[model samples]
Target chain A: MSTVIDARDLTKEYKSTLALDAANFQIESGRIVGLIGPNGAGKTTALKAILGLTDFEGELSVLGMDPRHHRDRLMREVCFIADVAVLPRWMRVSEAIDFVEAVHPRFNRARCEHFLARTKLTPSQKVKQMSKGMIVQLHLALVMAIDARLLVLDEPTLGLDILYRKQFYQTLLEDYFDENKTIIVTTHQVEEIEHILTDLMFIRDGQIVLNTNMDDMGERFVELMTSAEHADAARALGPLDERHVFGKCVFLFDGVSREQLEPLGELRRPSVSDLFVATMKGTYE
Target chain B: MKTFSWLIKREFWEHRGSFFWAPVITACVMLALNLMGIITGEVFLRGHPSVMVDGTHLDMIGHYLTAEQLRQVGAGLDMSMLSVTGVLSTIMAIVVFFYCLGALYDDRRDRSILFWKSLPISDRDTVLSKVISATVLVPVITIVVGILAGLSMLVMVAITATFHGANLWTMLWTAPHPFQMIAHLLAMIPLIFLWALPTIGWLLLCSAAARSKPFLWALAVPVGAGIIVSWFSLMGVFNLSSTWFWQHIVARMLLSVFPGGWMAYDPSIFQHTESPMALYDSLSLGHMYASLVQPEFWVGAIAGIAMITLAIFMRGHRDDS
Candidate 1:
């Protein structure tokens, strides 16, 4: 796969806080990568840097162009849902469609209208008159219509209810995603997007801690549930984390072979939520 | 070229109420008031051998005047037709001021700047759209509305004169005053744009930079400077003059957005207008073109261009907002 974004020593500082501290990562086209992190962990900062909405010191390239200098040109091939409530309250739905069509050469007006028609939003409806869910629907309709090579979504479904969140991802996957495009998303509701993500990244304190594709992750990480007798043995084997559930013990291991882990007890692939909890165990403190 | 036009259209869409409907409504109100005044005057002069039939303005005053005096009356009549514009332009000044104060700040306040930035449009284009809206679109709409109102009033007078058995209808079609007024107002647009840029640039800078209350910031800077200048001059701290600061700096920063606001500083306009007819004769396109060459005008215009450039940079770099 060709690289979509490549950054080496990407850094950003806001006064006393180093929001992104020499972070480095490479993303390939045709992958849905989830950049997961806790609050204030530089996920949004990194997205801003990539979008050229913020300045930083480092070498960064998106779609083979430096976003810092070519933001307007870069935007021709890149689309983003920066925030759901960001659509101006004074704008009408038709005006929003018309503006994007006028300014964005890649925008497909018919496609936007098709998506908008599925919703209850009318052409004359103003953004302020819509509910939070309806706003995201409108935003998604707008972004999905653009034939962009890259799509960045920062907390795209932040305040939405479960139904809206599930529907958002479903629509994105079915209508917007393609092998020709790359998607980078960050959200606190990691579990909702877990199943759709092809790759995972865990960041903390402006540093990327984990970067691996889903298949590599499955091969490198395993969780084992053992009886009381096997708990010590599991710990002796140096599992990354160990915990007790009822009278039984569960141990999570990183890069420990499945063949070696199988003889101890029942083994299953860990859920992304479990991995995230285990990985970010001490972040709050 | 197309993108620039769309960018301007976007601005018009957002501010049509103030930029368009405000002037239209003001002109309509002026016409209504003028119509009411004429009907009331007709009622009061009923059966009194009204001046309307007695060959009005000339017959009553012509017997007591010279040829030069009669020509002055004609100029006065020409000038009076455009008097309603003076009121509308004042209202236009307030509308444009508040619009500029909110132009950049409102998007940041509501976080819609993020949405706007998500498009391919650059900060330069976005800022230029607003600048053009304040300088060009506002003046054009207001001028058109003023002309429409003046024409309607002129027609009403012709009809009223005809009803009184006078052939003012022919005079109405023949009068060059309405066309002259339209040409004068149109010529003033470029002057308005040049003089208004300083205030528009100042307010836009405050709008893009102020965390809150841009109007207060825009106001406080110039007024505060004036106050400090006065206090310093009182103490003889420097060789500063307070009146010069208020007249040259503070007034231009606050009042330069008005149509012909630059002429307010020109003593010639008031000194010669001691006779009403001379006001029309003295204020011409040539007089306006002359104001363009003044050192003060170019200095203010250059400073405005600098502020506008700075505002563009600030809008792009202000990430916290």
Candidate 2:
């Protein structure tokens, strides 16, 4: 697969604080990569650098073009929903569509209109008149209609209810995602998007802690649940994180084979959320 | 070109109130007042019972006046149309000033800048769109509205003249040089736009750079400079009078509408001409064009371009989020 985003030793500094510190990663096309990080973990900074919204020290390229220099040119194929409520509140739905159609060559107005037809959004409706869920739906409808190769969504569903959040991802997956497109998303609610993410990158303190495919996660990491008697044997294998559940020890091991772990205790694949917690905790430790 | 057009359209969309609606409302109010004034004047004349002249009462003034005296009255009426145009111009200037000051700052404050920046449009295009909207589009809209308001006022006066048995064409339209007056007013707008560049550019720069209170920021810097210049003058360093700063900078802000001092319009036109048409004729477009090569014009243009370029840079580099 061809790489859509390649960042080598990317560094961004805001005065004394290093927001992105030699961060290195490559995102190939046709993968839904979740950039998971806590607040101030440089997730937004990294995304900004990639989107050419900010300058950075190392080399970064999106779709074979240097984003810093060819930002306008690069934007032709890259669509982004930076955050919730980014659309101007005073803008009417029709004006918004007209604006995107005029400026973006890849935008399909008919497709956007088709998507909006399914929602409660009308052409005359202003953004401020819509609820948070409706706003997200409108934004999503606009974004999904663009035939962009890369779609970077930074906390796209940041402030929506569970129903809307579920609907957002469901609609995106059903209507927007295809094998030819690449999506990079960041959100606080990791569990909500974990099922759809083909790959995940865990970042902390401007550094990547974990970068692996979702399918490979089970082979590389294991959560072993065992009685107190077998807990010491499970711990000998150097689990990355340990916790107690219902009077039993549940140890999360990274890179330990399941065959070896199964003999000592019940081995199960760790959920993405659990893996993320383990990864972050390991970094702190 | 398409992107630039859309960018400009977006600007109008965002600032429709200040750019379009405010001037339209002003024109409507001015028209309404003109109609009210004409009706009140007619009612007062009828109630007071002026002497009859040719089947209509014109005894208070028109019947007794000589042809020359009537012409002078006509001139006065014509000059009032110019005054209306001036009032509309003043209103437009004020609207544009505040619009320039807030254009860049408002989007960033509301976090709408993120959405704008996400588009394929460059920062240069974005800043230029705001500049053109302020300098070109706003003035054009104001000019159109001003013309309509002027016409409405003249029509009301013409109707009043007919009621008084005075010749409508001679008393109102012909004396005012209605077409010439409008042409002159329309011609002045482009010049005013060029002349007001420095102020517009400074406001835009402040709008882009200020994190909060753009008004205070735009005001404080110039006032601070004036204060320091005054202190230096007190020390007898170079004999720099405060009026020099006021004339060169503060006065230049209003110079677009009121061209005086070095680039002054001929005061003789007001003194000599009884006809507003003659007043417009005496005013030389050549002098206005000559002022283009003057040091003040070039200095202001260069400074304006520098500030605008800096604004573009700030918009590109600053991450407001």
Candidate 3:
């Protein structure tokens, strides 16, 4: 796979804190990479740097161009929905489409209209009149209409209901994602996006703690649910995290073989959220 | 070029109320007032015929006045129409002043700056678009509306004069020097816009730089400096009155945007010469255009460009939101 984004020792410092600290990662084309971290963990900062919205100290390239010097040129191939409700409230739906169509060379007005036709949004509706779900749908329609190489979403479905959130990802997966495109997303709702993400990068304290593909996650990390009698034996295998559920001890282990874990208890693959929690807790670095 | 055009269109979209609607409303109100004044003047004239001495008003020095005096009276009426337009333009200037002060700052306050930045347009284009909207587009729109208002009022006055048994075309229209008046008004727009550049540039810079309360920030520094200069001068510390910062500031605020002090010149010429034609003749497009080569104009233009460049740089680098 070709790499779409490459960062080496990327760092951004604020007056009182270092938002991103020597962070290094790569996003290959055609992969939906989830950048998971708690609030203030520098997730937004990293995305801002990638989008050329902020300056940073390091070498970074998107689509083989340095974002700092060529931000406007770079924006032609990159699109982003920075957050929910970023659309101007006074702009009518039609004006938004016209504006994007006029300014963005790759934007397809017909495609955008087609996307909007699927929802209750009409040309006359202003952004302020739309509900949160409608706004997200509008934003998604505009984003998907752009023939961009990379789409970065930072909390795109924030403050929406579960129904809209589910529909948001569903529409993205169904209509937008393809082999030639790459998506990098960061959100607090990790589980909702876990199923669609091909790879995950866990960041904590401005550092990437874990970087691995979803397929490899099963082999590299295992969750063993064993009775209290065998919990000590499971613990001996260096489980990355331990918790109790219904009088049974659940231990998450990394890099321990399934055969070794099976003897201690029932083995299963840990969910991305559990893995994220374990990773953030510094149990496995 | 296309991106810049779209950016400019976006500014018009956002500021349609100030750039388009305010001047339209001003025109309509001025037209209404002119109509009311014409009716009242006609009633008062007919009811008081004795006030007309020797077939002309006693105040007009009887009927011994020559055609030159009659033409001057007609010109005086035309000057009133121009005054109406002047008032409208003042309103437009005020609208544009606050518009420039808030143009950059409002987007950041409302968090819509993100939407604008997400486009493929550069910061330089965005800043330039706002500047053009303030200096060029707004003034042009106001001028168009002012001209329309002035002409409509003149037509109304001519119709009212006809009802009063007076010759409409030669007396009302010809006396005003309509072509010269229009040419002078048209020339004033670019001159005033250039003269006001320093204020416009400073407002935009403050809009870009201030996190909150941009109005206060834009005003405080200049006002504070003026106060310091005055305090030092009063205390016999130095003779800095030659700097004329305070004089220029007041002029920019009141007089610079006007053409050749016409607002002040109008009433005085009308009082002394008692001929609106004399006032019309005094309104010189040549004098207004002559200021284009003045040192103050060049200094303000260069300073305005520098401030605007600083605003662009601030917009690009200061992404606190």
Candidate 4:
């Protein structure tokens, strides 16, 4: 598959803090990659660098062009929903559709109308009149109509409830994603998106701590739950993280085959949240 | 070109209230007041039984007035039509002034710039859209509304004149030169644009760069400079007086956004004339374009372009939202 984004030594500074430090990564097409990170961990900053919303020192290529200089041109092929409620409050629904259709050459008006028809939004309704979930729905309808190659979503569902968040990702996967498209999302609710993501990236302190495909990650990391009797043996295997749960000891092992871990305790595949917790452990301290 | 037109249309959609309704409301109020005045005048004259508005009144006017006096009355009627439009222009000036002040800043303050930037439009195009809105679009809309309002007032006056036993169509309406007045109004738009350019550029710059309260920033900077300049002049520190600096820099940067604010351009446009037609010709496009010959216009135009360029750069680079 062709690479959609390639970055080398991408660094950004804001006065005294380093927002991105020598970050290097490559994302190929047709993948849903979750950029999971804690607050101020350079997740949004990295997304900004890719979107050409800020100035950065780096050798970065998005869709075969430097996003910093060709931002307007790149925007034709790349779509983003920068948080929620970014749509102008004064705009009516019809005006928003008219404007996007006018400027975006790839915007499919019929598809946009199809999406809006599923919601309660009318053409005369102003954005300010909609609830937060409705606003996100309108925004999604607008973005989904555009035939873009790469979509960068930064905390797209940050303040949403479980139902809205679930519907957001469901709509995204069912209606928007395709073999020719790529999506990069960053959100604090890792569990909600963990199941949909094909690739996972964990960032800490302006660095990528772990980057791997979900299948490989599942094969390499195992969560072994054990009683107190086998806790010593699990520890002897040098598990990456150890925790106590409901009078039982759980040890997370990396790169240990199932046969080796089966003899010590119950072996199960680790969830992305569990691995993310293991990777980001001690960051707050 | 299609994208640019849509961008302008987007601006209209966003500011429908200030652009369309504000002028419409102002015109309605002025028209209503004049209609009320005419009705009351009719009632009061009728109440005074001797003050009859029949053929006798026409005979009295023809009997008491000379041809020169009758001609002056015709000029007065024409002047009244022009004057109502003059009011509409004032409201237009105020609307354009505040609109420019908030053009670049409001989106940033509300965090809506992100949505605007997400589209394929360039920062240059976005800023140029604003330039077109403040210069061409708003003024054109106001001019159309002004002409409509002027015609309504003239119609009301003709109705009252007809009631007074005069053929207003031949005697009054013919003297007004409505088409000439309309052409003159349309022609003045370009002058308004040039004179307003400096102020538009300065306000938009503040709107882009100010972190908070762009209004305060736009106001304090020029007024503050004027105070310091005047203080220095009071101390006799410079060869030129403070008025020169205030008129050349401060007023150009602030008050030029007001309609027909090229007052510094030739006060002789308002000079007493032999007739209302002469007065109309004095403020014609020829007299207005004469200001273009002066270096001040070019100096302000160039400075305005520089500030606007900087504003565009700031809007592109500064990602505070």
Candidate 5:
């Protein structure tokens, strides 16, 4: 697979504060990658750097084009929806759509109109009068209307309700999926996106603590719970980390196989959220 | 170029409420004022004074004036009323300035800048639209509205003057010089731009810096700064208001010219213009439109360009969210 995004020693500093440490990452062309991080973990900063919204120390490229040097060209192919409810206040829904249509060479007005219809927004409703969720939907409609190669959504569902959030991801999946397109989404709702993500990357303190595919992740990582008597033996299994929840000792193991772990109290597939919690709890060398 | 027009169209649409409402309201108010002046006869019959009693309070208070002097007084009143329309021009500037502030700030607050930046347009187009809006488009609209108001004022004054036996043909034919009016207007281009550039630039910068309620601080800070500057500048100068206006105009002209200090020109290009009261005598007939020919004007314009360039770079690099 070709690398759609490549970052080497990416570092961003604001005054005396370090916003992003020396971070290195690569994303292939066709995969839907989930960027999972806690609040203030530099997820937005990284995305902003990628969008050329700010200057950073390290070299980074999207589609083999340096965003710093060729931001306008790079932006033409890469669409971003940041804080999805921030559509301009004075713009009518139609005028905003027309603005996008006017400026973007690849913007498809028919597609944008169709998406607007699906969202139940009228062409003339002023953005300031719309509800917050409706604004996000409008923003999504605009972003999705563009024929972009890469879509970077930062907290796209931040203020949205469950239904709107579901619709958001559903529309993204149905309308935007293709071999030549890539979507990188960062959100706090990991469980909701676990099914859609082809690959998952967990970043903590500006470092990628976990990088693995969903299929291999299940085979390589297991969640094992043992009775108090067998907890010590379960701890001996080369687990990534263990935690006590609701009076039971649950452990996450990476090196041990299912056949070799049958002696533990219980073995089951760990949900991405559980794995995220386990990974976040421990010290990784 | 097509996209630039499209952008301007969007600006018009966004400001339709203000643009439509403000001028209409202003025209209505001005029409009413003109009508009031006509009916009262104070506007077109000024020198006539309704009576010629000057020796004593009540002795000739009821006495009337000669027909010829009354007509001359009417002519003078008509001219003064026509001059009153100049107030409408200033009103137009205020309304247009309000709209420009909203336009400049709205782009960043609503994430419209992101939408535009994502497209193929350069920052130069984005910034130039503001200059065009303030300098070209709004002024054109203002002038159109001003002409309409002036016509209305002229008609009312002529009818009222004729009622008092003044010659309507003379009032109409030998009216103020349209060329001189246009000349003063041409002179106002740099003055208007110079007076408003920093405010616009500051608003643009603040818009880029703000995430929410973009206009609040974006507007308040610059106005607050202007008030403070005006206050301090007013304190030191003897005839402080004139000096303050001159210095302010010069500074704005400087920003407009050098945007990023591409030239080191003095702001005196604008400073040398006569005050509005003295303009009739102090200004040469040709000098009203002569501002465009100055090297200092170009230098100030370059400074303005440089400032806008710096503002765009700052906005592009700054983290708003």
Candidate 6:
């Protein structure tokens, strides 16, 4: 598969703070990549660098073009939803749709209107009067209307309700996804998006600590729960991550087959959230 | 060209609600006030009087008396309401300025730069739209409102002047040269941009710089900086002369965007000692035009371009939200 986004030794510094440090990553085209990281883990910085939003060291490219040099062209195919709340507070829902229609040559007004109808939003209603959930729904509708090849969403569901959130990705998957389309989403709610993600990237402190495909993740990182004693034994088999819950210990092991890994403890499927928690705990070193 | 038209139209659609209604309300209030003044006999300055006959401005008493007997105007009005129309025009200009600033800050604050950046348009187009909105559109709207306002003034003046027995035909047809008034307005445009360019630049930068509350910082920080610097400059605590101040302001405002020489007039001209237009005319300031073509002006010009470039660069990459 061709790479849609590629970053090599990317570094970003703000005043005295190093926001990103030699971060290296790439996303294949026609795949949904979940970028899971905590706040200040440089997920935003990395995304911005890819978008050419800040001056940074190292090289980055999206769709084979540097964001700094080909921002307009890259942006034509690569759209982003930064924050839904600030989606032009003064604009009416229809006006916002009209704006997208005005700017994006590939924006489908009919699609936007249909999506708005699904959300039960009146086109003439001003966005300021809408609830936070409605704002996300509106933003999602507008973004999904664009025929962009790549969509980057940063904390897209930050304040959205569970119903809207489910409806959003569901709509995104149903209407927006195609063979040429790719989506990179960064959210802490890993499990909610895990099913839609073809690839999962675990970032920590501005570095991609783990980059694994969903199928590979499911195979390689077998979550084995055991007594506290077997946890140390499980760590011996190349532990990728581990965490404690009550008095029980769970471990994620690398290069250990499920059949053989089962001997160490009680093997269970690791959810993306469990993996994220284990990664954060630094137990799966 | 279609994209540019779309940009202008989008601005109109988004802002037209506020832009249109605000002026219409002001216009209604102005027309009402003028109609009130026309009914009463108080439509003139304390020493000077005027009024409108049909569409024509007439100053003679016979014409105003002829017109007065025919109409009651509004609210049992009198001449004292003439100033209301003048106030309306000034209010309109102020409102337009604020509106332009708000429009400039809107995309940045909304992070809708993402939306625009994704389009087939350039940063130049994006930045130029704002410059046009502020320097051209806002001012053009203000001028139109001013003309409407000027009409109101002329009507009131003609009414009172005619009431006081002045010549009506001369007031409308033989009035002072309209061309000269137009020329004065044309001259004011560059000067207005020169004075406010820094503020404009600041707004554009802040829009890209902040994720939230962009305008407050965009407006406040610069005015704050200008005040602080001017205070120090006044107290002899800073060595930068007014000439240097103008140069810096010009550098920051117009940097790299266009001919830096745009603001390269002689320092003495800005002094209220003489009106800028009179100074421009008397000095045959072809020298001022010559100054703009210089390398120094180019350097300042480069700065303006660089600031815009920096803003685009920041806007393309940064994720404030």
Off by over 4 Å in 1: B49-74, B234-240
DockQ list for all candidates: 0.81, 0.78, 0.74, 0.83, 0.41, 0.37
DockQ of 2: 0.78
Off by over 4 Å in 2: A282-285, B47-77, B170-176, B234-239, B250-290
TM-score of chain B taken alone, every candidate: 0.91, 0.82, 0.83, 0.88, 0.63, 0.60
Error of 3 at A179 (Å): 1.0
Residue A186 Cα positional deviation in candidate 6, in Å, after optimal superposition: 1.1
Q: After superposition, how far is residue B2 of candidate 3 from its true place, in Å?
A: 2.0
Docking class of 4: high
lDDT of candidate 5 over B1-321, digit per residue (tens)? 888988677667766655555666777787887577455655455666442211111112124445644444344433343353355455555655455445545666556566666666666676667656756666566555655665566566555545555444463556444334545544555555654455455555544455566557754654566677676775455665744554454345323322212112334334534643333333333443344465545554465556566666665665664
For model 1 chain B, the run of ten residues with the poorest summed lDDT: B53-62
* Candidate 5 lDDT tens digits, A1-285: 799999999998877777789888999988999999877677888888888777888899889888876787788899988776567777888888878888889999999988888777898899889987898889888888899999998888988789999998999999977888999999999999999999998888777778787898888888888778888887776788888888898888886888878886788889999888777764343
Model 6: CA > 4 A from native: A225-250, A263-266, A283-285, B13-23, B42-89, B96-121, B152-321
Least well predicted 10-residue stretch by lDDT in candidate 2 chain B: B51-60
Q: Per-residue lDDT of A66-147 in model 2, one digit per residue for the tens?
A: 8888888888899889888888999999999999999999999999999999998988999999998898898899889899
Using TM-score as the measure, name the better of candidate 1 and candidate 2: 1
List of clashing residue pairs for candidate 3:
B75-B276, B76-B276
Best candidate (score: TM-score) = 1
Q: What local lDDT score does residue B166 receive in model 5, on the 0 to 100 scale?
A: 48
Model 5: what TM-score? 0.79
Pairs of residues at least 3 apart in sequence or in different chains that clash in candidate 2: none
Clashes found in each candidate (C-alpha, N, C closer than 3 A): 0, 0, 2, 0, 23, 38
Q: TM-score of every model?
A: 0.95, 0.92, 0.92, 0.94, 0.79, 0.74
- Candidates, ranked, DockQ: 4, 1, 2, 3, 5, 6
Per-residue C-alpha lDDT of model 1 across residues B97-195, encoded as one tens digit per residue: 998899899999988888888899898998989999899988888888888887787777667766665544554557566688789888888898989
Better of 3 and 4 by lDDT: 4
Model 2 quality (TM-score)? 0.92
Q: After superposition, how far is residue A117 of candidate 1 from its true place, in Å?
A: 1.7
How do the residues A1-285 of candidate 1 rate in per-residue lDDT, one tens digit apiece?
A: 899999999999999999999999999999999999889999999999999899999999999999887888889988888777899998999999999999999999999999999999999999999999999999999999999999999999988888889999999999989999999999988888889999999999999999999998988889999999888888988988888899889999998988888989999888787888898889889
